[model samples]
Target chain A: MNPIANRYTELVGIDHPIVQEGLGPFRTPKLAAAVSNAGGLGTVSMPGMPTDLDAGARTFREHIEECAALTDRPFAVNIPVGVDNNGVVLPFTDIYIRTVLDARRVDQSLAAQLTVLTTSAGFPGDYIGMIKDAGLIHQHKVGSTRHAVKAAEAGVDVIIAAGFEMGGHAPSKAVHSYVLLPNVTEAVDVPVLLTGGVRDARGLASALAMGADGVAMGTRFIASSANSDWHPTYIQAILDAKEGDDVAFDGVYGPCRGLKNAASLKLLNHQEDGTGEVIDAVELTRWKIESMQRAQTTGDVTDGLVLTGQVAAAIDDIIDIAHFVPNMAAGAAEILRGLASALPDTEHAFS
Target chain B: MNPIANRYTELVGIDHPIVQEGLGPFRTPKLAAAVSNAGGLGTVSMPGMPTDLDAGARTFREHIEECAALTDRPFAVNIPVGVDNNGVVLPFTDIYIRTVLDARRVDQSLAAQLTVLTTSAGFPGDYIGMIKDAGLIHQHKVGSTRHAVKAAEAGVDVIIAAGFEMGGHAPSKAVHSYVLLPNVTEAVDVPVLLTGGVRDARGLASALAMGADGVAMGTRFIASSANSDWHPTYIQAILDAKEGDDVAFDGVYGPCRGLKNAASLKLLNHQEDGTGEVIDAVELTRWKIESMQRAQTTGDVTDGLVLTGQVAAAIDDIIDIAHFVPNMAAGAAEILRGLASALPDTEHAFS
Candidate 1:
């Protein structure tokens, strides 16, 4: 095993350094539990209910309870705080955070097992004190080194360097993982979890070599059996993709990378023609809710956009969690070992 | 737009199909003359002894003399094939080819007008037949499908698919343009030229888009005052590359890709690991000669390995070509004419 392996293992208390991203609506109790049980961190996204903070809190609590029942291993919850549709406040920021904290206070079992809380899409500096006070590790997703530095200063436990290749709403500024990972890792003292365009063992090896502690995969896990209900066509499209198939489109807030299908083409055209103006928070919420409902319930890939990472290019096949998680770990370990063995001998060898 | 524009238009008869492959020692004055004077072809290879029976008759004839004296149209000669030790074979190939054909028997002035003869590796391919043959055009060198196929099959008249990514021995297999362009365009029936990795607009746009009639390039071309050698680091690396960067070992005979580096990994490695041996001829050559040599010559990019055409990865920055070779000629013409305004009757159209 490589030295980074031991360090990552110690940091995450897992056999491998693979972390599954929190895919909202797609993230279910079973999926989270399966990833956690597979010896990697799994995260569940807090449920949102438009403007009704109380209702959203209730949904989140129930979801948390379900995830707790599914796995005995540690997992996390992702809270996204940012501007919403209609320019009106969504209230998910404070409501969701307080709900998680309140739930931790009331449920001893949940508090004991929930190992991490991931904050994404917006700054988490304000909530770091609350999260640490509750004794949970904090992970933040950052698109640039500046964001990473900010996260580090805010006491983020792990920094996820999300590059432009990532699916869903990625930062508009374009910085690839190759350039971003090294820069961010060098700047921050915290352990870095590299995201975006990482799909296989080779990618893992490369990232570790570049100074990342672990990899967080979104698209790869989404294609697994745990996500069987995901539209088969979308899944197949991802599987068939070669490296450069995807194109990023301007989303409501930023850029989102997905399959270049008719809907996406329409969105791109809209951006180009300057006709698709930004909808406010309420309108955005309704639009997303409707789109997700159409997509998830009806299996309309065109209606519901799938969030994926650039690593989708390498995912030619999908397997069960039981097989995938272990294979990923083993493959990385083997490559790392080979790389280490090839290195020139040092004075500390065997001593 | 660019200075090369007038030269390109004059050299290639048809608006967009004319190109030259940067061949090496194999490049001959007759070959360049045959292509350029034909009004459709241009070629460039190494400026050494013409190898082969036909070249002997054409000996003492310089690339410039043969090409310029043959035709007034634009033509070019590539000289970088002599940079490495393997280039020794270039003179031999040139001598043999020149000897077999009585090139001296032909009109020397007519031969001097040959347009282009791309050169790379040991020597250019023996092209005395096409040069001396009736109505034959010649162009050579390629990097990928975008580089070779159009030239090969379009009958535009010579094609060279070179795959040295940055410089050095071409990869034995996983990353050379030889394997990529050929495999993708094997159906082509025209003359195919091969060169190492080229460095220019004419090279980039032509090869990546598969529209070149032939290729003529030199890393040193950019270092010219007439050239734009983007970076000093890139220029020095190309000049310093060795035979290894240009040679392949264990080649299966066809083509391969990759750069020379410590890993020495090839596409063959993925074919079948059970036997612990390579099973394909093409793959073997790619690793041994092409990829290995490329690594040695390119420096740190030895790991960078300069093999392109698994394109879809944004590996190269796009440079402007003096000429525009539309991928779809008819469609481009229609768009250029603003035919949308001339469409009759229906304001609405259905696919």
Candidate 2:
């Protein structure tokens, strides 16, 4: 394999500067392993609060083990810094984090494989050292430049700067990709990966041009053949998706974007102002986030939410997971080469 | 000069694939000519409603004549189709369109230089024929894919797809640049130019990757030195701007983005119910749009509105207007070359 060098690739030891986003609350072991084998940093997203702390840890451990068994390549696990609406820490976060950190301690095979930890949602300051101490790269995702600066200050190894267009739990600040990407990349010293509204090679190439070292895509991965374990109709929902198919859901700390359907519409319609008689907003938010995963399993487009980014509108066809990253890498490579070939003969370089 | 071939450049007869946005509601004769002369399409934004219909037409004609006097290169004029809150068409739109069309007929020398008419705010279907019959190129700017299809069906020569992040009058739909751009470009067959949130060569390169033929920047142009005719402090304001400094003003059909100064704050806070108000909301919106010009002339940063896009937050320094397009061109060229040189040999390229 030809090594395309970048800070993100070097830091994570990946062949391509692409990260598979943590899609929904699922143990996507096959999907993650498929991406990693194809030379991209595949990430297994921590599933929603399991029956209990033990179940949550067991689920995370199973995912890590399953992915390790499938591929010899390095992979990462995403654990959102679980925090409630009231800024209080939630349960199951520690259980999940320890599962990834101690998985190598439990099994030597997975130790070298699960080498990276990506934390999102809440602040990473308290956990950055813990992650680093475990001998893993800590990459934190942020929604705004202020949050990015905060994440960088916390001594995170890398920053995944997400825009408002991302599916699942997105940044509270509604800053778009092009606007937020350059800002965070310019502000922080850490290598930045762009997320949200990115679907293909052009999106990846555009991220590199925007000063991001790599890209982390969630919606694109959902449409991949490797994720065929999900309902075929769910994948079909993504392909049949058109512009403006996504809507916002008040989940966790902020709004999460996903395909608008009966489930999502119900979330939108629940515009509670707390004036009504006794409503658990935070619990309801958590339930809403958890319910989204049902869409893929139940194959119900209306009752369950199909979490995807605004980029879903542009995705006309589905590609096999085997070709996804390589295709994106090669397309970006060709685009850059094409642009290079078109360069004018000149000594003048812009500062 | 090496010609960067694109539909936007070829259609508009510009060397580089860049278009300077029509700024504010005043005569920008010097600004328009300088960009056009510098091998990019410079646009003269139609001045706001004059004292009367005769005065409005006269001011537009004068601005067109002045732009023609400054450069032999082609330039365009932007006429926003003003629509009120109650779905009423505001006055002075027809007069302005006629003025642009008849100006060339009034003075044959002005005909070739003022070649394009870009209609925004409302539908262009009503006046597309009049301009086409006048033998002028019709380029309309729309905020969404639906509007782009409508404009294309209206027989316009080009589609300038503007995103929600744009300054001044923006679409009611809050679709972002990457989302709106690819959507419109895919939906319509016409040549598309991405507007809003573009600052430098990276932004232009990203737009090209997203399938846009070119980029039109309003906030970036405001920070240029060639625009020295405006107050220095105004440029300084743009330089000092940070992310989220720009916000939406509920003017006309949608929000008008600008620096969140005293004037914009007042507009936002003026959330009228239209219950018992004797004032016309349409006239109020028009006045708000017109009053934005005072920021350049009066230099009252607090009281007058400063129209700029989200990209303003990233701009730190100013360059001469002469170097703007060339700088962007060279920077994009270098970036493309750099990416090309860094590419690894691969057998994969996405179809």
Q: For model 2, how does the per-residue alpha-carbon lDDT over B1-351 read when each residue is reduced to its tens digit?
A: 643555667777888888888774855888889888888888998777665779877878788888889999999999888656675566778888888877888877788888888888888666889888998888888877888998898798888888888888888766778778878877889898889889888888788767778888888887777776688777888899887788877765578888888888777766433233355865776667556777877676788888888778888888677777877876776676666666655223311
> Which pairs of residues collide in model 2?
none
- lDDT digits (tens) for residues A1-351 of candidate 2: 543567678889988988898864865888889899989989998877765789778878887788898999999999888776676666777778877877778777787889999999888667789998989999999888998998888789899999888888888767778899988988998899999878777787788877888899887887777886688888788889776678877665678787889888776666433233344865775566567767777778888877878878777677777777887887887776666555445323321
For candidate 1, the TM-score of chain A alone relative to the native chain A: 0.89
* Predictions in order: chain A TM-score: 0.89, 0.93
Over 4 Å off, model 1:
A1-4, A84-90, A228-234, A240-244, A276-285, A342-351, B1-351
- Looking at model 1 chain A, report the run of 10 residues with the lowest lDDT sum: A339-348
Residue-level lDDT tens digits of model 1 in A1-351: 222344655766776788888666543566777788888878887654456778777888787788889888888888875655544434777788888888888888998777788887778756888888888888998877788898899888889888666776676565555446666776898989878766666556546645577888878887788765466766776787644456676554577776665656666766655466766755764665555445544667765654555556557787688677767766665554443332223112434
Instruction: State the local distance difference test value for candidate 1.
Output: 0.52
Q: Fraction of native Cα contacts kept in each candidate?
A: 0.00, 0.50
Worst 10 residues of 2 chain B by lDDT: B342-351
What TM-score does structure 1 among the candidates reach?
A: 0.53
